[model samples]
Structures are given as C-alpha cells and as structure tokens.
Target chain A: MSQHAQDYTPSEREEHQAMHLLPVRRADLPFLISLALIAAVYIVLIVGILAAKVFYVELPLIGEVFTNPGYRYAVMLSLISCSVTTILSLWIAVPAAYLMTRVRFPGKRLVDAILDIPIVLPPLVIGLGLLMLFQTPPGAWIQQYVRFTYAIPGLILAQFMVSCAFATRSMMASFAEINPRQEQVAVTLGCSRSQAFWMVVLPEARRGMIPAATIAWARAMGEFGPVLVFAGTTRMRTEVMPTTIFLELQVGNLGMATAVAVVMLITSLVILVLMRVAGRGMRMM
Target chain B: MIEFQDVSIQLGSFALEHVQLHIPTGTYAVLMGRTGCGKTTLLEAACGLRPLQAGRIALMGRDVTDLPPGQRGVGLVPQDGALFTTMTVADHLGFALRVRKRPRKEILARVEELADWLGIRYLLPRKPHGLSGGERQRVAIGRAMAGHPDVLCLDEPFSALDEETHADMIALLRRVQRDTSVTVLHITHNRNEAQALGDHVHVLKDGVLERQDPKLWKK
Candidate 1:
C-alpha cells in the first residue's frame, strides 16, 4: 500500500474511497477553470455596476431622495405598493400555484404556458396589454366603476399582473418539491382537500413563501416599462422609484436619478438578505 | 373490510388493468410484487389517492368509488412516512383527531395512548426531521392508526429500515393489528415481510392479482 493509503484512519479511508469513486481527471482542469472564469466575469460586472453607483453618486442628492417631498412621496408609494403587491401576489400565487402543481385538467399545458406569459413577455407588452384591455367594453365598464387607467390602482394592477406571475412560478416550484404523498396521507387522515392544503401542504411550503415574496417584491420594485405605460409618471401622484428615476433622467438630473437607483438597490439588497436569513431560520426549526 | 372490484388504473406508460383485491375484516393482507409492478399504484387506488379508470372500491362495505379520499374512511402509511415536516410527533399523532374536530381532551388522551403503544412516548415532542427510520415509520403508523379508520394501508413502510429496526417494526405491527383488530393492506416486495406478517398473501404479476397461501412464498 502507498504511504498515504497506510496513513488513513477508518473515517479518512472511507472519505478516500468516496473520492476515488468519483475521481476528477487532471485534464478537466482547463475546462473547469474556463467555466469558473465565465461565472466570475458576470459576478465582477454586477459588483462593478453596484460599486459605480455607490462611488459616483453624491451623498447630498441621495439625502434629497429622503428629504425632498416629491422623492419622499415616490419612496413611500413604492414601499406601500410593493408591500401591497407582495401580499396580493402571495394571496393569488399560493392557491393558484398549488392547483397548477397538483391538478391535472384539460388545457393544463396551455394554462401553464399562459400563466408564464407575463414572466416571458417583455414588461412593456404586459403594460400595453393592460392598456388595451381597459379600452375594451368590459375594461371600459370596469373602468367606469373603479378607474384603473393611468391611476394609483393602475400602478398596482400593472405590478400585480407581472409580479404575481413570478410569485406563482416560485410557489409552483416549491409545491412541486414537496411530496404529494404528504397531502395524500393527510387526506387519508380525514383532512379534506382544502384542509390538507392548510394543514399539511401549507406548513411544509411555508419556507418557500419568503423567496416567493422576495422575488415578487424585487420584481415589483424593478418594474419600469409596465408602470410607465400603464400608470403615467405623474410626480407625487402616480410616481414610484422606477418612474422617479425615469422622470429625473428625462429632466437631465443625473445625480438624482443615480441616487434613486442607489436607494432602490439598497432596499432590494436588505430584503434579499432578510429573506435569506428568514429562510435559514425556518429550516433550522 | 376492503375490496377492489375490477380496478383499472393508468399512470403514464405504466398500467394495472382489471385488478381485483380484497382484505377481510381484522386481517393483515400483504401484497407482493416486483419493483415496478404497480404495487404503490394499487395501494393509492385503494386509498382513493388515484382516480380509477374502472371499478369500485369499498371500505367497510361502503362503495367509496365516488368518494374523496378524506371521506373514504381509510388510513395510509406511505413508504417514506411522508410526515408533516412542520409538525411535532404529538401533532402528527393528533392530526386526524384535530381534523375531525374531536374534543381537545380526547385528542390528547389518544395521542398519548398511540405514543405509548408505538413505544415512541419520548419522541412525541420531537419532529420527524431528527428521527431515525424506525422512529419515523412508527410515527407514521401512529398517525395512521390515530384516525381509527375502517381500513389501514401500509406501502413499503419497512423497506428502508435496518435489520434490527425491521424486526422491531414487524413485531410492533403484529402487536398493533392484534390489539386493534383493524383491517390492513400492506404492500411489500420482500417475501420475508409477507411471510412474517401476512394473514393472507396476494401477488401481482403481469397486471393480475392472485391469492396465494400465506406460508407459500415461491417465485
């Protein structure tokens, strides 16, 4: 036996055997390095962009984002809308995603593809579709009652239209990851379908809710084209962070635009971090 | 009593056609088959988890073909235990009682009784994530039997246990059936399991189920 082989303790020998079973060849080094280098390039670019925003932007302008009433209203609107949208998205997404994952109905494939339309379709098209929908007789009828065109409600509708799709996708993957047998066992234990969902499926899928909400909130915060087209960028009225950035840029206030973008980046990062921490906490339980 | 009258089920490329099975009241019946011979499919169909293409399922002499799983009065212990990850062992034991809206005192008494019967009184406070394979299966059995259904179905519950644990589980199940006198339909490919626990044995081969002597476990 080789010296290394002779030196290995029982645990070490087992690990060594495992390592040998899935041996990596030295010739694969260049291929592995190339794959890692490609990944690093994307990582570097993301960090580089974020760093540029933090470094190049003035602090006073960012301070104005909090102090200025127009920006303040926009920030408050963005926070409120994103929060509302996240809640609304989950309300729809959880049940819809669960159904999509569990049920097999006619036109299920078509329904699945249609559900993904907002995710795959350009944001502008979603806004345009909303825009065109409100012009139809049914849309006009609903508009007469609620008024969604170029209004605060329009902002939420546009965000929900797109954000709910993402939330649903996340939830669908979550439900799919859970074993159907759990729900079956619950049913056999005298739980009705809805009761099984509430008791067995929902609790297991709870950890997944954080990421779904995070994704929905992040997508809603970053939403630009849909909000712009569906809800006009009216300052202090229908303005949000994304629209604020657009309005600032249109007026050639580069500092203000960068500041708003930075604020958004920070908020999204905080949410992402909180979500990851909460997910970890749930798993620990 | 549990009966499958001319049951037919199709899942993707795999199918079980015109399958008939019956387990008499208070008897332990084990169904043996090859790995992909639709053992679980049959179990699921009996539990009303799967939609039957043809035939009726009766539990306690009631036709459960049109009934949903929850209304079928059946209890299931799946292969993996499929315990609720978020619930404690006490919660799992009390789950069916809670679902049926039984009195809280009654649930507590029953949960304690089941925990004691399964030799898992110490595990009642813990979750399934920290359990051993034998413990999880015991919890699954407790959860199923907690419901006090007309029939209980166990699908390969002992397939993942160590030898000692397997033997313990076999003895525990035998004792459980003896004590409760609940009708049971257990599925296993292991001939030893069938021989050990089966009061009646049925083998599924080439889409057909045929009764065999419980003592005869020939190929």
Candidate 2:
C-alpha cells in the first residue's frame, strides 16, 4: 500500500466526514410526512363526526327524554347496578390481587391467565355464553338456587365478569410494582403477612386501585350486550340506561339515544378526573 | 442468642446450604460478604421470611424455625432503609407497639424518646420518601429498636449513605448497641464497615461462613 493511502483507510475517512454531517437521513422525511398525514386525518374524522352529531341531528327532544320518569328510573337503575358491580368486582379483585402478587402456589399462572380471558372475549359472546349456560339444566339448577337468568343479578354477574378482569389486571400491576421486600420488612418489624399487606402494600397500591375501580365502574355503566342478552330489556324492571338507549335507537329515537350517550360520556369524564386525582395522590405518597 | 443449625434454602440459582452460626446475646456481630453472597437471605431465613428447607433457627433458647417473623422477636433494617412509605416516622415506630397491643401513651412516649435519641425528632411528621436516605435508615433502626427485639438484623444498612454519613451512622449504631444491650447481626460488603462496627466478623462466600482473623483489618 502507498504511504499516503496507508495513513488512513477509505472507510475511516468516509466515517469521519459522515460524523460531521447532520444525522438526519433522507429516509426519515417520508416517515415524518406519513405520521403528520395520519394525525390530521384522525382529527378531521373526529371533528366531522362531532359536527354532524351536534348540528344535523334532531337532538332537541334529548332534554324532554331526560325528564321522562321511565328514563330517569332506567338511569337510576343503571347507576345502582353498576355501582354494585364495581364494588363486588373490587371486593374479589383486591384479595385476588394480593394472592396473585404475594403468594406463590400451583396453578397460579393458569388462574391469572383465566382471569384475563374476559378482557379478550367479545361482550356479546360473553353474554351469549352466560345466557346459554344459565338456560341449561345445571345452570337451571343454579337458577333455582340463585335466580341467575332474566334478573338484575344476571346483569350484575355479566358486568362483574367483564369489569373484574380490568380491575384485577390493573390491581395486579399495582401490586407487582410494590417491592415484596417492603412486606418482608414489615414482618420483621412484627407485622403478620396480612397486616403488612393491609398497612403497607394496600396503601401504596391504592392509587392504581382507584383508577382500576373507576374503569370498572365506567365499563359497567356502559355495559349493553351482556345486560340485554342475560337480563332481558324489560322496561322499568331490568331496564338500564344502556339498554334504554339501545331500545330507543332500535325504535328510531335518535335524540334519546344521543342524550343517553351524552350522559355516559359526562359520567366517564368525571370518573377519569377522579382517577387522575387519585393517581396524583399516589405519586405524592 | 440467635442460633442457626445447618439451615439451607435454595431459591432458583442461589443457594444457602449448611449454614450454621450463633449470635450470642448483646453481641454486635457483622456478616461481611460480596454481592450475591446470600447475606440478605441469611438474615431473611433467621427472621422466618424465607422457609428453611433443612435445619433449624432458635431465638433465646426457643426453636423458632417454623415460627412466623412476627413471633420470632427479631428486628430487621433492610438496605434502602425499607421505611413504610405510607407511614410517618412516628407511625413506623409505633407499628410494632400497636401490633403488640401496647398502650397509646407508652407507644407515643417510646417513639418520642427514640426519635429524640436518633436526632429525628423533627422528622416525626414526615413520611419515608420525604426524608434523606440517612434519616430513613435512622428511623428504620429506631422503629426496629422500639419493639425491644431479642436481635436486630441490619442488612447493609449503611451502604446507601455518603462516606461521612456512613461513618456517622456506624458510630450512631455502635452507641445505640452499647446503651441498649441489643444483639445486632449487621451485614455488609465492606471490610472497613465490618471492622468499624463489628465485635466479631464472619466473612461469607457463596453462602458459606468463614471467620476472618481479627487483626486483618482493611485500612
């Protein structure tokens, strides 16, 4: 090799020159443009839908629909049922979460995976499955004992199944993030396992639990498919807000349906705000 | 006295096997080892946090091998202090007292005394996260000591502090041990810490305990 050429390799010299150049490559422009285009399209579609719903729809009858005694009853029933569902789900989920995080036993992975199945299953499928199961002989026997079919209990059960999965998943994550060493330390400081968890772990996990509860509650509030299939849309009986909205939409009562949707949206927003506040509190702790 | 008789535990790849030792009453013994040498595991096993696959653990002449940690009469201060993040310093100090059903005034009085002793009287109202690492460790030690345990297990308790703070804490721990007659099983990776704080030192390697020469002090 010539002395001059030996002083520096062609690759090294080229690398040196490239290092001085701005790192942005020609290939990035297309990606940036595509991302911008997708964002714009998403915003435009959302705004267009909102504009149509606000201006073109005959929504004035929504105010009268809210005043209707039957609608009010449906709303109240939905709130009460969903609240019960949320509480029931949390009651089961907190202990299940504790067991899942703190203890190691056989079939724990299987139990965890099974708990997560409802999240992946479609709501309509879950409803149909529940309906079929409850309608069968073994389920009929259960109904005789517990009254599972065409009742408020059936609606709560369906909502519980769907919402519990979400609550459990959130709570499990919360528990996992907590160092088990904290509880161990507690035990060393003269706390029983349950005492350690209740005093230390639960308080730390409370922030995550709050959001999880809110999500479950909102999910129960908007629950329609399972409630319709299992509970039967009986007006002033098993009828809930989502069921009422479904019935109204079926009968071409667009104004009432939108009003119910608006109520649900507002409720969800309030719950989300509460969850944020709880999350902030947790962070502070 | 806290005694371990050939205790062995296998947690995944790490194993603490055939570990036998004794910490006599009111002795300041330090377990020195490198990282992953099972010092923490030994402390945990002694406290009944980890189930022993073999052998036994005894505290003050009673075989507490199968006993739960709460009944073992042992206090532990973990690395990073492990202060109850949800609790104030006073609350952490009062926790064991409350569990033992001690009177409210007694608990408060003891907590106040310990807080004053540790120079954490002003930190009584603050939670663990708000305090500095040294303050948290002090609170952890105070909380453990408040219960009047048979033995105090400190696992690398001074490793989180700066050099000056580390020295101060070692001196503080020594002073407390002298005044309280509490048996301490302090664990550390640093030989200097072992020398400074330990009356008897046990060097651990791969879960095996080996006593080092008392004269072989590092620095």
Candidate 3:
C-alpha cells in the first residue's frame, strides 16, 4: 500500500535484488577456474612474448628482416615446411582417427596410449630419438636411399613427427563427437561402408579437420628444438622462422630476434582466426 | 520379409539369446517391450547392424546372415530419426537412391514424389535442426522407403511425438502401406501404439518374443 520509492513490498524488492545477485550466486566457479587456468597459460607463454616484442620490436626493422636473404630463406622454409607437415599430418591422422574412434580391437588401448608419446615427450628428446633412428642399420638403408638428417627434408620430418600427434589428437576428438548411428542408418539405406564414410561420416567430421590442421600448422611453424638437433640450424638450408630468432639472439640482436618472434605470433593468431571462421562457415552450411 | 532364427547377439551388458522372429511381406508388425528389453537389439541383429553370435538371418528369402547391412536390403529409421544434421530434408529422402548411383533425374523425381507423398515437400530444403518431431519422422520414413527395401525397420519412431502428432504419423503409415508393399517391423513400448498400428504384434520379454492378441490381429 506504501507509495514511497524506498517503501516496496518484499516480493517486488527481492525480485529486483535477485536480478543483481543471481549471477554472483549461480556463477560456475569450477568452469571459470578451469578456463582461467588455461587463459593464464596462454597469457604467460604468448603474452610474455608480445610484451617482450613491445620493447624490442621496431616497425622499421620488419623491412630489414624481410629483405635479408637469410631471413627470407627462413620465412620461406617455415611456410613450405609447415604446409607440407600439415598435409601429411592430416593424411596420416584422418583414417587413423576414424579407426581409433569406430573400431574395437585387442591392442587399441595400447595404440591409443602410444599416440600421446610425441605430444608428451620433450622436444629435444624427439629430435634425439629421430637422430638415433637414422643411425641404426634399417635407418641407414633408408638414409642411403633418401638422405634426411641435416637436410631440408629432415626439417620437415622432424616437424611432422611432433606436429602429427596434435593433429591426430584433435581429429580423434572430432571423430569421437560424431554419433555412429548416422552411418549405421546410411548403411541400411543402401550405402556401403566406404560410401557411408565418404558421404555421411566424412562430411560430419569436416569441422574437426579445421582445428586439426590449424593446430598442426601452428605447431610446425614454431618448432625449434627438433629442427636444431635433427635438421641442424644451417642457414639457407634447414633454417625456419624459429631458427631465425635463435640465430639473431646468438649475435645478441634481441630486437631483431623478437621481431621475428612477433611475426610468428601474428601468423599464429591469423591462422587460428581463419580456422575458426572456416569451421563456423561449414557449420552454417 | 525378414526372418531371424536362433540368433544370438551381445552388446555390452545386453544380449539377444536364441531369438526367433518372422515378419511376413506387406505387414506392419509391432515388437513391444519395456525400455532396455533388447527390442532394438533384435531389430538391429536382423538388419546386420549387430552381428548375430550363432544364428541365421534371411531377408526377402535370401540368406543374408553373413552379408553386410547394405547388401541385406534393409532400410532403417532409428530412434530420434537419426537424420544427418548437416544434410537437407531432400538429401535425406534421396540418400539411398544416390548411394545406389541412380541417374540424377530419376533420383530428383523420386525425391519429389516421396516429398509430396510424405507432405514434406515444403520442408525439403530445411535442415533437421529446424523440423518438428513429426516432420523429422516423416522425412525419416521417406528416407527409409527411398531404397525400396524389402524390410523397413523403425525403432521407436513415433515415441517422441505428441498425441495428435502420433495419430497423424500412424495415419501416414497406413497411407504409406497403401502406396508401397514394404514389410515394416516397428519397435515400441506403448501398448496403445501396438493396438492401433500393428497388423501382427509380438511382445518381447527378457530377449524372448511371443505373438500377442491373436484375436485382434490374426494376420
């Protein structure tokens, strides 16, 4: 019955205050904590580099780096190697992931456990392992036929071994998210297994491909330790964008080193944005 | 026609033990059971979606126990319709014909005919996410029939619809039977649905099937 602005019914005032308190009360603490932890990781690894770039990066030096023959060769190798690595990784991962998700086999759990090795192992250890493999008798036979160590091919191979795991993991997640019932229905409606796969299952898994390929490409772009050990940091030979930074830092040109680093950061961001956009477009279609 | 004799299959904790079933041609049969009673398992075994552990399956008088599902000439409309979310309704209807590599003109014409018959021509371009429960089921039925399969197996197809929609779908099935002679094995838990739609009804309990309501649906 009170008409004063502050004199309100309990129900009406509570409803008004509830709007303000609801978010604070119902906030998903665990999810926010999980997201914040992941965000903290990105901020530390990525933002630290960007912050370093703010002091060391001079816009005019970009042209100097671009014009240098060594830098140009590094950039070209990075582009070419990452592209090949991404393609090879996807080619290997797609079918492997399909099997991992759809098939039931005796050693499947072991095989799945093995896939995480490259992902979890230290980068230098992978390079060292590749080096040891090349030194073995069977590896020697292949080396005679196709020399990889200390060569451009070695650079690609090292990147491939490391980045392929990321590709496979993402693709496995993609394939796992899809329900097998759709393909089963397709089969009963007269589609052979392969037909069902290519028509129904593959199309459904297309969204997964974007993330798989993007993450692999970014990983390949930043690969340093494996390339340094297995491929060697030879100028105009196995040099890539990451090696360019190492070479610059060797001479104490920290500004020039961070400039190359800044370029990689920009490249990685652009790549992720493109993949997300492509994924959204495919979903809409 | 579909037949399963001495069929034994297991999936996780569920099993179909020595199950025997027969659906004669041109009949709309309902297989009724409580939820998780393995009714869908039996249906899937006949369709070759699940391998039978120890028995024979025959489809349209052919011994297809060891054959692949596509080779068995079965058209399945699974629970929730299972329509490909990415495809249009027209794509769903034309899927079988496309898989068989029918000529484009023939496939399009057949799709149009089915779309008209199922009253989903206007919804053909829409994706599954936009359709109502009844609309999705209609598209699914059309899709299943597109292959001209000898047997059409629907697993709880109408269980998701409202009462009005359920009745409408039942009437649609009757019309579909008038138009085509496909043998249908529909799985459901509802006694009322069995009474309304079945020409021959079978009750499944503990992985065993028994013919029910002899006086009501003698055929």
Candidate 4:
C-alpha cells in the first residue's frame, strides 16, 4: 500500500497551527458534529444547486444558453452595470468610510445607523424606494435630465443602491485595520491632512479596498430584486442573467433556466478566482 | 523650542491634569517614565497630534496650541517607527518635499544628503518589509528630520534596537541634534538611554513632569 503513505505524521507547521487552536477532546464531539452539520448545510445549498443543474439538465442546452445572443447581451449589460456600479460605490464609499472612521460629530452614530438601513432593508424595498423617488416631483424633474426609472441608468441605480452599502461597510473595515498613528506621522513629516490621507492611509488600505470592490461587484452582478422592481425585466434592454433565468422558468423552460444558472455559477467562480489573484497581488505589494 | 503649559488631556483610561513641560532650543530632553505612564500621550499633545483640553503649546516661541500637526512645524517619530509599508526608504525620506511640491533636484539632493548622514543609502530603494528594527528606526528618524522641522519629537524610537545598535543610534541622534540644533523631546523607559543621549532629563510619573539633572539619570 505504498508504504502506508509515510505514516502521515503532522509537520512542524501543522503543529504550530494547532497551538493556536483550542484543545479537542472526546467531550467536544458534540460541538464538532454541530460545526460539521452547519458547514454541510452551507455547502449543500451552494454546491448542491450546481450539481443539480448538471445532472438534471442537458449539456447542449447549457452550451446553447452560454452562446445565446440574448443571453450574451444580458451578460454584457450585467458586466457593464455592475462594473459601473462598483466604481460609483467606491467613489462614495472610500470618502464616506474614511469620514466615518476618522471624524466625529453630533449624530455620528446615527449616521452610522443610517448607513445600515440599506443593508438591513430588503433588496426589493430598496428598488421600490428608488422607483418611488422618481415618482416624486423633484425626482421627476431631475429625471428629465438623468433618465433613471426603467432605463439602463435605473438598472445601475438599483444595483448601486443594493451594493454600495456592502462596499461602504467593507471599506470601513479596511480603513479601521490601519492604525491612526500612521496618518499622524505622515502629517508630522510635512504632509497636509489630505496629503497624509491620500499618500499614506489610502495606499495602506488597498488590501481592504480590493475585497470591498470585489464584494460590491459580485453583489451587483447577482442583484435581481432591485433590478427587477426598479429597472424592469425588459428583454434585451435590461434582462440580466438572474432575470433571464426567471423569464425562462416562467415559460417552463427548465433546461434553459438551468443553463442560465450554470452561467452565473461559472461567472461567480471566475470572479472568485480573480478576487483571489487580486488579494495575492495586494499581499505581494 | 517646545513648551507645554498646564496641559490637560484625557486619553482612554489615562488622564493628565495640569501637566507642565518645557524644552529649550537645541536641548536633547528625555522624558523617562514607567510603562503605562502618560509619556507618549504627553509627547503627542506637545506635537499637536493630540488635543489639549485646557492649555497652550508653544513651538519656537509662538503659540501653536490650535495648529494642526503639519502646520505646527513639529516632526514626530512614534514608537515602532510606524513606517508606511507601501513606501520605499527613499519615498519616506522625500515625502515631505514631494508634499510641498519642491523641485525634483532639490528633493533628490536633500534625500541623498540625509541617506548619507543616516548611513542608509543602501536602503533607499527597498521597502520596509525586509528591514530590521534598527534600519526601520533609522528610516523613521530620517523621515522626521527630512522636513527640516523646527522641533523633532521621538517616542521611544530606539527601544527596538540591540544594545550595540542602540548605542550607535544614541550617538547618531546626538550628532543630528548638534548638526541641526532642532529641539527634541524624547520619551523612553531606559535609564541608560536617557543617560547617554539626554542633555536635560525629566521624569513623568503620576501624570506630572519633574525635572532632573542628566547626571542623576543613571542613579
């Protein structure tokens, strides 16, 4: 049996890693079982769906959806909208997160609480709120110039509304990891307040920002509720991957819907790989 | 020159009330204190990095109680060097010059001059990740002095160095103080460090400054 795989002794690195972990015993079996069960629940939900799609659906149908012209446009639109939304979200989140971290004022805590409103609220409700805003007099007047409701801009707005909160939260966590003393030293070294922030704090926070942007992009890419409600599921105009799957399923096209789901799964995996690469690149820097 | 008159500030669980401290121009003053004493707090307040509730800070004989850190003309090297991990050693040295939009040639010359004086010319191109404690501290001191600051504040900058490196750093600091005549307010726990480098020594205990002659530092 190949020399019993060299006896499988733990390496020094493994022993060191185990040093940090709490001691395990027979009494911990129940806790370990519970942990395994919880992990299994999550794995089943994520992996099970992809497995089901491959097993129940025809391979040619999945391939056809992959190359479909309508599905292709949906993918392009989703990419464009999500990328734009991520950029806009970062533009707002970076400064907002920095302000939240550094500055204090009356109602600062309340402002923090308000930021969570978007995250806590249902995605569809956020979309409905955006739609309701355009129905208001000022929103309608502004709409004359900015085309927001049921338009491509509205689709981006919906994704941004849902994704920006996550972006801000992630960036805030990123900025928090940096010690405030770094900025103080930068200022003492003759950099102005803004200079210290831009040159020192921002560059140092890049690692955190990468995850923030990636999470926002992924959230935008997969966003359905807000886009459906605010942007509308217009064919070829606003139909994204999630909406495409919905429309196909409405007509009892199981194979088509499964194919669209597979596309999303593949795209998500690709994004995850890209995120890992970016994280590694950031660490190298 | 640096002066803190009746300075009062509360930081976390520590509080300083009616603390008075003064350092004359060109004097190498060390504030020695036990761990958890408000030594770094005092240093920060004096440098305009921390706000004082009720008192004034004067640098170079002018009131700077309300000035921001950059405008107060004070340079600070915090404990652990706090070097920007993203920057090369040269960038750290030239950061102040670049901020002020100084000429490229001038910035280069000043950085080169400092690198030579600090004996860190070899480290200019390298980032801080591979630097030893002594090298990091040297870079930190160089960065602080790069601005040609009116007053230089150092918070235990040499504590991380080995005994030999520590002694070398003390000599280097004394040489820098003599060459530039910049006022210095350093805080440290090491009595030997205070004895070797301080022209005037002070002890901070129970949130107050008590002046002592440098001769008594070893005792």
Best by lDDT: 1
- Of 2 and 3, which scores higher on TM-score? 3
At residue B108, candidate 2 shows an lDDT of 94
* TM-score order of candidates, top first: 1, 4, 3, 2
Evaluate candidate 4 by giving its C-alpha RMSD to the native, one decimal: 6.1
Q: Which RMSD values do the candidates have, in order?
A: 5.8, 9.6, 8.2, 6.1
Q: Give the alpha carbon lDDT tens digit for every residue of A7-96 in model 1.
A: 223345687688768556899889988999999999999999999999989999999999999999999999999999999999999989
User: Whole-model Cα lDDT per candidate?
Assistant: 0.89, 0.82, 0.86, 0.85
lDDT of 4 by residue, B148-215 (tens): 99888999887777888888888899999999999999889888888888888999888878898878
Q: What does candidate 2 score in Cα RMSD to the true structure?
A: 9.6
Candidate 4's error at B12, in angstroms? 5.0
CAPRI band of model 2?
Answer: acceptable
> Which residue pairs in model 1 clash with each other?
none
- How many clashing pairs per prediction, in order? 0, 0, 0, 0
Which digits, one per residue and each the tens of the lDDT, describe model 3 over residues A1-285?
111222222345577678777463446888878889998998898767678786678987777778989888888789899999999999999999999998898999999999999999999999999999999999899999898899988999999998999999999988887768888999887788888899998988887899899989999998988999999998999999899899999999988887788877877888889888887787778
lDDT of 4 by residue, A21-71 (tens): 987899999999999999999999988877888788778876787588888
User: Local error of candidate 4 at A45, Å?
Assistant: 4.0
Per-residue lDDT for A1-285 in model 2, tens only? Answer: 011211122345587578898766788989878889989998999888666555644555556556888888887788888889999989988889889987999999999899978998889889999999987899999888798778889989989989998998878877776767788878887777778877888887776678679878988987888888888899988988888878999999887787776666666677789777766666566
CAPRI band for model 4: acceptable
- For residue B65, model 2's alpha carbon misses the true position, in angstroms, by 1.4
Please name the candidate that would achieve the greatest TM-score relative to the true structure.
1
| Chain A TM-score from candidate 2 | 0.81
Q: Give the least accurate 10-residue stretch of model 2 chain B, judged by summed lDDT.
A: B210-219
**Pairs of residues clashing in candidate 3:** none
